[model samples]
Target: MAKKKKKDAYIDPQQRELRELIELKKMQQAAAEHPEEVQAEFEKEEPIVPKTFKEKWKNYWYHYKGLTWGGLAGVVLVVWLIKDIFFGPEYDLSVTTATKYMFSALNDSMSSDLASYAEDYNGDGKTDVTYNEITIYLDPEAENVDVQMNAINLQKLMAVFAGGEDLLFVLEQESYDYVCGGKEGIFIDLSALYPDIDIIEGDKLILNDTALGKKMYLNGLEEDVFLCVRDMGGSVKEDDESLSTMERSLDFVENILREEYPDKFPAEEAPADNSSEEAR
Candidate 1:
């Protein structure tokens, strides 16, 4: 049996263990040499996900939660544009105006007149035409007495451009200049609109001029405001092609003042103080 002790080909246990350790050392070296590749492989095996809707909204709100007035003004502009585009096209005409005092009287009179009045465009005995729709906004020329015209936000001014309003009553010269832009076509020339009337004052339109039939001086205001039509003569109704919005506006306001209170005329001269006279 011992004649040739079976020739056995077997590795020692220590040698096998040493071989495994060497393989492990090689793997460690490879991993060390390409750490980013190893990390990428790990990520591929288990990837991260995006946040939920509520989390995103909360993050967005946090971004704009502390915006200033100037930032808010931009938001207002965006909102105005959205509303202008998405809203109904039923409005026949639009007016953009500023001043807290002037708008009150004008808005009241306009709303009343629109509900009760109609014009006979074709003169066929029936004045059953859609009255021009007028919208008024309470925008101010300046935030305060010290604020410059350029410093103002002019949201309502831009609204006119966006809404395509037919009429604009401007109380601030800075806004007027911005809209007109040095004889540009944002506003129709008063001279062209009314050749018979004279509103030009050295190449400028005067608000207190008699061309508007009578001065539309609102009470309690220190200055006068100007009125002008849009450059394109925007109108909502086909019947309004011939109808003059500028002329109608002047007539509407002047006629109301004349018919309603003929006593307030000349507006410059108040009745002599009768009590003072009697006392004298």
Candidate 2:
């Protein structure tokens, strides 16, 4: 009790009232000096509504430009895909190759040589031939042993097959055997398509020694390579369009086989053979 009385002896009631009064005076001075700020604090905010289409659009874009542009881009992409896939004419020929020797899609050498045989099948007044390559390192010593790339190539190959029945395939002998060597129906027998030509053995069209092959100058093709056409006789996807396309493809193949090169090849057939055996 004596300690409590001693603590209260130092307490100042006047000091506590003075401190409160000082704070109240400071707030009054702030309100007096900055009345607009005080008024703004109590002001009711108005929701702005645009009166015209232009103003509305501007305001809407200001708030949702990202979504608007993104949606527009998505719509354009969808429209393009729809037009390209369904309505667009298929390439005069689509080839899926499982060898390392085929030309890149960008390189027009092989396609150009092959194009000489293409018959404007789509009536587009131009011959369109496209090549899709599957990266299969059949060689044991190949260093590019990427598993992800292998999967992607496999997926691409399956998509090719799924897209149509009348297509071309350029493949290695081992890979050919893995696909449809013993099987007769899966791959069209080239003998039937190019019966008059001699370079074909069953489904294999010996691409070498042909005019097209000579033009291609398939170098680094260390192993036996062949060109094959997918058989559409038993294909479930065969439709009227595919049937017509296959007829044109057969004609194209026949033309390529019929193409001839002279024994004493023209010296100008190529810029003097600066190519070594690897580039032959």
Candidate 3:
């Protein structure tokens, strides 16, 4: 049961001030020893230097190595273009060469198809005889020297083969009132083989016959020729007698050409009334 007495503490302001001053001096001395450390700790951080356009471009180039090559490639292409403009494959616009190339392409294509057919004569391994018919057409408006040559070449071939014969070479020229129009041309009617036959006014043969008139229209004679000889309905097999007849007819025609019109072989003529009737 004893009461405790509170002890009064005595404070010294000068001593307290002195202690704070001493602590502050120590901090200053430490800071003075390492100025960079104080600056790094207390100083505001400097903003980073912004990249220049050129430096940025360099960085981009590094990222995309292909871009550098692409620029070089563009320069190389420009140089090549310049070279070609001044010097390139000799600009060949010769009519003769053009004509030659056109005909050569056409003949080559035809020959290739025929060769294929010849190789595959029968379903069995046997060689069957096959004939190729090439028909050329000249456009009335197409006046290139090459086109003329093509027509001439076709005519010559027909003359050489046809002589004075009944062999069919379909060359029908559309008549122009005063001057001959080249609108008319030859066609190989294969409607029998292909039912959808369309007679177009060009050298090429349209392969389908059933599509005739639907896609393209045929002339009267052309339809007859297609229906009579070239179609599946026509007799493809040439018997010995028929072949012999053809040979004789061709020979006779050749003789007639030689005797009558020596210049125009396989020349066409109006049949005599009796002869025409007999022919029909």
Candidate 4:
């Protein structure tokens, strides 16, 4: 059988189909006599049909499903990260204290009480402030020191300093100047924030003297507890939330410095008169 020469010119679909069908039927009839030769001819004349997108995609996924799924997961993770970074709840202020005990112990009472002092800076429909407590009593270089514990304490303190997010610090008076801001101090001068009231140093507030200190039992402690802000009386540069925290810290300080103190903290009350009881 003679084969038709290949041509570049297009043919009508119906005519092309009819012609191909006739050729196939003829080859099928002749295949009984010369099976191998007819099969070769049929293979040579088979049309090159383009695969549809759906069929191509199926084949592609079969070979590279792992790569495709991994890429999709990466894309989803990136999107989620972007959303969290751009629109996430930030702490209104941070209280970092280097004390014998952790602040988490009183977190519930503190959070409930302090919630009334601050506005929702993060706009999360609730007030929030982080409470961090670290331990570092003796100097790391002191004689007979627990090197490993001191090292851990130093590591935590260094981390806190490097983070720079702690708005306020509650530290022992002796450690205040050395740990925080040297002689001048890194704290915002409360005198400027509250010109009327005479507090500790211009920046420092002696917690032992305040109602807050009484509530925390600071008076009984051997070391005097001092509260100070990181802001340098407008001399220091502000980070992203520094100013916001400064504003909130001032409000919180004002609440703490209120003459009557926050009502939530149990106040020292006079015992009831026994005169009426004696009369009875």
Best by TM-score: 2
lDDT of each: 0.49, 0.71, 0.39, 0.69
lDDT of 1 at 131: 26
Q: By descending TM-score, how would the candidates be arranged?
A: 2, 4, 1, 3
**Model 2: per-residue lDDT, tens digit, 25-95?**
99899999999988897786676889999999999999999999999999999999999899976678765
User: Where does candidate 3 stray beyond 4 Å?
Assistant: 1-103, 106-110, 119-137, 146-151, 157-161, 164-205, 208-280
Q: What is the lDDT of residue 241 in candidate 2?
A: 74
Which residue pairs of candidate 1 clash?
none
* Model 1's TM-score against the true structure: 0.36
Q: Taking the tens digit of each residue's C-alpha lDDT, what string does model 3 give over 1-280?
A: 1232222123367776888899999999999998999888766777544399987777777788898899999999999998977865331110111111222333444333222322331245533322234434444574444676567765654453333222323222321111112322221333332333233222323222422212222232242222111111123235664454344323422332233334644555886669767888
lDDT of 2 at 163: 67
Better of 2 and 4 by lDDT: 2
Over the full model, what C-alpha lDDT does candidate 1 score relative to the true structure?
0.49
Worst 10 residues of 4 by lDDT: 1-10
Name the lDDT value of residue 32 in candidate 1: 100
Better of 2 and 3 by lDDT: 2
